[model samples]
Target: MLRELPRIFVNIAGYRDTELPWTIKDLFEKARHPERVFAGICRQYAPGEDDDAAPDGVFAEQCRVYDVHAKDSLGVCWARHQTQKLWRGEEYAFQIDSHMRFVVDWDEVLLDMLGECDSARPVLTTYPVPYTPPDKLDSPVLPVMFARFFDNDDIVSFGSRISLPEDAPEKPQPSAFVAAGFLFGPSKLIADVPYDPRIYFQGEETNLAVRLWTHGWDFFTPNKVVCYHDFSKRPERPRHWEDKVDWRRLNTVSKTRLHHLLGMEKNGDPEALKGIENFGLGARRTLAEYEAFSGIDYKRRLINGKPGRIADLPAGSPERKADRKRRFTFIKESNGWGCEETASGGGSTMAQTEAIRRDLPGVFDSLNIRILGDAGCGDLNWISHITGGLQAYLGFDIVDSLINEAREKFYDRRNHFFSQVDIVIDALPECDAIICRDCLTHLDHQEILPALKLFKESGSRYLFATTHFLGKNTEIKTGGWFPIDLTAAPFNLPKPLITISEEAPNSTKSLGAWKISDLL
Candidate 1:
C-alpha cells in the first residue's frame, strides 16, 4: 500500500526562464521521504533555445526531473500527456504550480484523501484564499482569478461547499471548476481524460469540470488540507486600458470556444455566449491602445520565447528596485507580527486569546509551536498553553492594526491570519526554536539576511524556513517599482538547525514540532 501511494508530481509548464520559488524548494526539503516525490518540468513552449538545465542544489537531490518540449497551444494538454506517460501506476495524482506555499504533510494528506475517495471519483480544488488581498482594483495583486469567466455573485459565498456533485456525470452545467492547483484521481484517470487540446489559453479546467460532471464521475474536496499560491503581491495598473482589453479578448475567445464545444448555447442560439460579446467594445479599445503604444505583434509573439507569461513579472522594473525595498521594509514593519509591550493593546489581547484557545489539552500533541519576536506577557499566555515548552524565538516585526483589521474582515480569521507573512512575523515570541510555515518567501531578499541574524540572536538553536533561486530575467510594474524577480529564483536558505524531518504534509491547524536541543 505504501509503495502504491501516488508519487507527488509537480507540473511547471512555463518554468523555463522562471526560477522556482523558495516555498517550493522548502517543500523539497521538508518532504519526509524526498525520493517518493517526482518533479516534471514541462519546458515545451519556452521561446528561446533549450537550456535543458535541471533545478540545481537541494531540489536535485531527491527529485526525478524531466524536461518535456511542447507548445503553448498544448499547455494543459501537454501536462496531462506527461502525467499519463509518467505516474500511471500511482495511487493518486496532484497538479500544482512551482510557487505554491504549503504548511503540512501534503503527500500523506493527498494519499489519505485519495484513499477516502471511491477509485471512480474525481477531485478538484478552488484557489486557496490568498493570505492577503489587495486594497484596491489597481493595487499590485496577482491575477489569480479569471474574473472574466466567474460570476462575482457565485464566488462571493463560495466556501467549503462542493458546488459540483461528486457522482454527477460529465455534463454541461453552471460549475465553478477549481482551476490550476488541485489533485485528482489516479494519474490514469487524467491520462485517459486528457485536457482538451483545443484550449489555447485558459478555460481548460472549466471545460474539464463540465466534461467530468457530464460523465457522472463524482468530485471531492477534503476541506482540511490547504495550500496557497504566491498571489500576495499586487501589480501596477497598466498605462493603457488596451493591454487589459487585449488579454480580455483572448480570454473571451477561449470562453467562446469552451461554450461552443460544450453545447452551452441554448436552443442553438449563439447569443448564449453574449456575456463574452458584451466585453467586445472594452476589449477593442484596450487592444487598439495596446497595439499602438506597445506595438505587440500578437502572431509572432504567440510563438515568442518569453519563458513565462508577462503577467508573472513583479510590479516595476530595475529602477523601482529601491521602491520595492522600501515597500518590503514598510510591509515588514506594518503588517508583520511581534510581541506586545503590554497585554492591553489590541494586538496583545488578540494574541492572548489565540494562545489560550490553541493551548487546549491535546492541541500541541500533533502541532509544533514556535513563536517569533519577543516573549511578551500576551505571547507567554500562548506558550504556557501549548504542550511543548517554548522551543524557539525567531524575531520579526509586529503586525499593523490596519492590515490585521482588513484581513479579519476579508478572510477567515483562523486560516488567513497565520498565512500572512507580515502578520505572523510581527506576532512571533522569543523561544529556543523557530517555526516558519511557508512564511519566508514573502520576505525581501535584503531582509532575509537581517531576519536570519535576528533568528540567530534570539537564542534559537533551530530555524525552519523556505527559499528559491533568483532567475536572470526580471519583471517591471507600472508604478515604476521593480522588486526582485521571484519567479526566476528558487529559495536558497541554509538549515543551520537539526534537520529533523523532510517534507511532510501539515494540518491547517498545526504543522509539526521540533526540539530545541536537537539543533544544539
Candidate 2:
C-alpha cells in the first residue's frame, strides 16, 4: 500500500491588492506538489475601480476565490472567515496575506519544519522578512516576534527581531505568539478554532494565538525563510480604514469584543460580544495554561519579563548593580536612548505627557506641593509646561549634561533649579511631593523597593509616580524596560489615594498619588 501525500489548503485574504495574482502564481510555481495544493481566497475588491487582478489559468482549477466587494467588506478577519468557509478538508492549512513571494519547494519546507517540531500538533508562523515587489530580498533571515509593550488599549503590540545563523538546527523554534500574515497548521484549525469575524483588525494575531494555544495547538517559527512578505503599504493601495468613514467605531467595537474574550473587561458592547460564547476557549487546555506558557497574564494585562528570552542577572548581581548606577550617565553622554523631539521616550511626547500636564497642576495644588522634586527628569520637555506656580522646582537627574543644559535653558525662571543626583543613592531634598515618572520602569525588580524606600524617607508627603495599572511587575535587568504594577505581589502597595489616567480610553498607564505614610 502506498502512503498518500498530504495536501495543503492556502487561505488568503486580499483587499485591493494588485499582487494577488502574482502571489498565487509564485505559490503554485514554488510548491513541490502544486497539483495537491489548493487555495481559498476571499478577494475583497472594488469591482470596477480596484486594480486587483484575478487568479486564472491552469492554477485556477485548483484554486477558489470568494469575491466580496471592497466597499462592503468588513475587515481582514471577516474576509479570512469567509476564506475559512471555503476549506475543503485538506490535510493542512496555510494562511497568508495576498502579497508574498515564496521559496522553491516551500510546501515541502513547511511540512519538514512541522515534522521537526516536538509537539504532536504544531503551527509554523512568523513575521517573514520584507521583500520589495517583483522579487527583491536583502539577506532574508528567520524572525521571531516579541512583546514590544501594551498600547493605550492594553493590546499586546509585537516587535520582530532576526534570529541569526539561519542554517543551524534546521528545526522549528517554539514561539509564544503567532503572525496573522503567515500561519501554517493542521486543517482542523478551520473547524476547531475558526477566526472570529467580529474582530476587526488590531488584535487579530493576539486573539488567534490565544484561541489556538488553548485548543491544544502549539506555535513555532520556521527555522528558515519559507516566504517573503511585502511589508510596505503602498499609498495607492486602498485600505478599509481609508475607504470606510466608520472605521474608528468598527475598531473600537472589535477591541471591546477582544477585551471581553481575553477576560480583561467584564462589560463590553453586548451586541459586539454576542455569540462570543460559541468561539470561547477550547477544553483541550485552559486559558491559564496558555497564559503560563506564553507568559501573558490576560486578566492583569501583564507580560512576563522573559517570555522566551533570557534576562540580565538578578538584582544582587554586581554587574547589574554597576550597570544600573552608570546607565543614565552613559545614556546622556552616548545618547543611548534616542528620541528626536526629547531625549526621553515617546511617553515624554506632548500627547503622551498630556495626563501629567493636565492633572499634575491640580494634584500639586491639592497637596500644597510648594517645593517639587523632579527625580529622573529628562530634558524637562513636558514638566517645563507646569512649573509656574511652585515656589521651587528642583529637577534632579543622574545625567550631568542634562542638568547643565536645563540650568542654562531655564535660567529665566529663578525659582526653577537643576541638580545632578541619584535618588537611589543620594539624599533627596525635602519636598511636599516627589514627582517620579518614567524612571522605575527601567530599574531592576529589586532596585525599585529601595528607591521607593528612599522616596518615603526623604520626608516627601506624597509620591506622584507612574504606575502601570494592568501589568505584572516582572523581574528585569536594572536598566531594561518593563511595566511595573506597584499593586501586584512583591510590591504589595496599597491603592493609590488618587489615580489620574496618564493615557486614556482603557490605557493602563497612570500617575498614582500615594501618601508617603501609606507606602509604609
Candidate 3:
C-alpha cells in the first residue's frame, strides 16, 4: 500500500494505551514504504517505572509525537487537530482505530480495492469481521456484510456465512452507512469533508454518511477481509465518554444539530444550517435522493433500504412459505399502517405493492401524465417510484399526523405535495393518472365500489389499483382488513373498466390492472 501512495499521514489521537506503541511500530515495519509513514500522535501514558519511554528521537524525522497529560481528557476532539497537523503530501488517507489486527499487506489490499473503483470519489469501509486473542478459536468464515438500518436509525448488518460475492461491491452495492472505525478514501475527500470538531462520537457515522453523500461521493466495502477489529473493551483502560460531564446530553445535542444540517425533521429543525464553519453538504445530490437510494427517511426515523430489515422479513410455515414470494411494492401508505422498525411489512402488500412500484414509474416515462396521488392509506414506497420528470405529485394519507411529518420530510421536493385527505370523505382532485394500490382491502364492504368510481372520475382514462377479488374469499365482515367481494353485492355495483386476475410472487393477494374507461 505504501508503494501505491507516496506518503501516509497517520493521526493517532486520544489517551493512547500501551498497545498503541506496538501497533504503531508494526504499521511502519509491515509497510513496503515505512519511510512514507508520517504519524502524528497525541497520548498520555499511564505512570509506571516499567513503562517504555516515547520513541521520539529513535525514529528520527519519520514520526511526530505529542504527549498530552493523562488528566488532559482529549476525546474525539483530537481527530481534526491531529489529522491537520500530520497531513503531509499524501495521495490518500485512511482513518482506523488503534486496536485493530491487519492482515499481511492489508495496506496493499485496501489500496488495490480502492483503486478498482470507477468513481472519482470512493470510500471502502465496513464494520469488519471480528477476531479473538491467540488463546481462543480461529476466526469464523464471514461474508462481506450487506447492512440494514436497525432500531432507531442504528445499523445492524447481516450476510451469508458461505459464498461471498467477489466484485466491485461499492458501485454495485452501495453502503447505507459507514463504519467510523474503518473509513478509507481519497486525501482530498478527507480534506473537503473534515471531521466536525463539534460533533460527539455517538452519531459520527450518520453525520459522515450524509455529508459525504450530498458532496457527490459514495462508500463501499472491499470483497475480502482486510482487517479484523477486537471489540473486547478492557475495563482497566479508561474511556473518554466515561469522563465526560454529561455525554448523553452532549450526544443528543450533536445528533440534533445533525438533523438541522441534513434537513431532517425528527429533531424539529433547530435551525436550518446554510453551512456550518468549514463543514456542510455539497451540491452534488439532494438528501431525498440519498434517502430513496438508501431507504432511510430521517424525518420519520424509518429505514426502508432495498436489502434492509424491511426486505429480510421472516418467512411463514412450510405450506405458507412455498406460496410466499418476496415482493416489493412502493405504495406511500397512510399513517397508522405502521411498519416494524426491525422488519418489513406484515405480508399483505408484497406482490401488488412491488408491481405498482416497478411498473408505475415506467407508465409516467411513456405517457405524459400530469399528476399522481399516493393516497395516505398504505406504505411510503411510492415516494421512491419517482424523483423527477413528473408535473406534480400529490402524496396524501388518511392520518393527519403522517401528513404533517411527510410535509416536513419531503418539503424540499418540487411539485411534490402532501396532505391529509380521506378519499371516502373528500374527493381526491383530478389527475391525468392515479395510483391507488393495496389499500382497498382495508375499507368497509360498502365503501369499495364508491372509491373505485371516485378514482375513475378523477384519473379519467388511466388508473391502477391492486385489488383482491371478493370472489376468492367469499366472506364479508362489514368493515375489516380482508377484501369484500365486489361482484356479489345485493345492488347494482359500480364495476371497473376491465378487471383481470393475475398471479404473482410474494403475497397470496391477487393483482388486477384497471383502466378508468373500462371500469366506468
Report, for all candidates in order, the number of backbone clashes: 77, 0, 18
Off by over 4 Å in 1: 1-6, 15-23, 44-54, 57-88, 122-124, 129-176, 233-253, 265-520
lDDT of 2 by residue, 453-476 (tens): 889888889888888877467776
In model 2, where do residues sit more than 4 Å from their true spots? Answer: 1-3, 305-520
List the lowest-lDDT window of 10 residues for candidate 2. 306-315
What TM-score would every model get versus the actual structure?
Answer: 0.38, 0.60, 0.51
Better of 2 and 3 by lDDT: 2
Point out where model 3 deviates above 4 Å.
1-5, 14-16, 44-60, 77-81, 133-173, 266-277, 305-520
Reference-based TM-score, model 1: 0.38
- Give the winner by lDDT: 1 or 2: 2
Compose the digit string of candidate 3's lDDT tens values, residues 60-168. Answer: 4777766655545444644545555567767767676655556667666777888776678888877765655322323533344443333222323223233344433
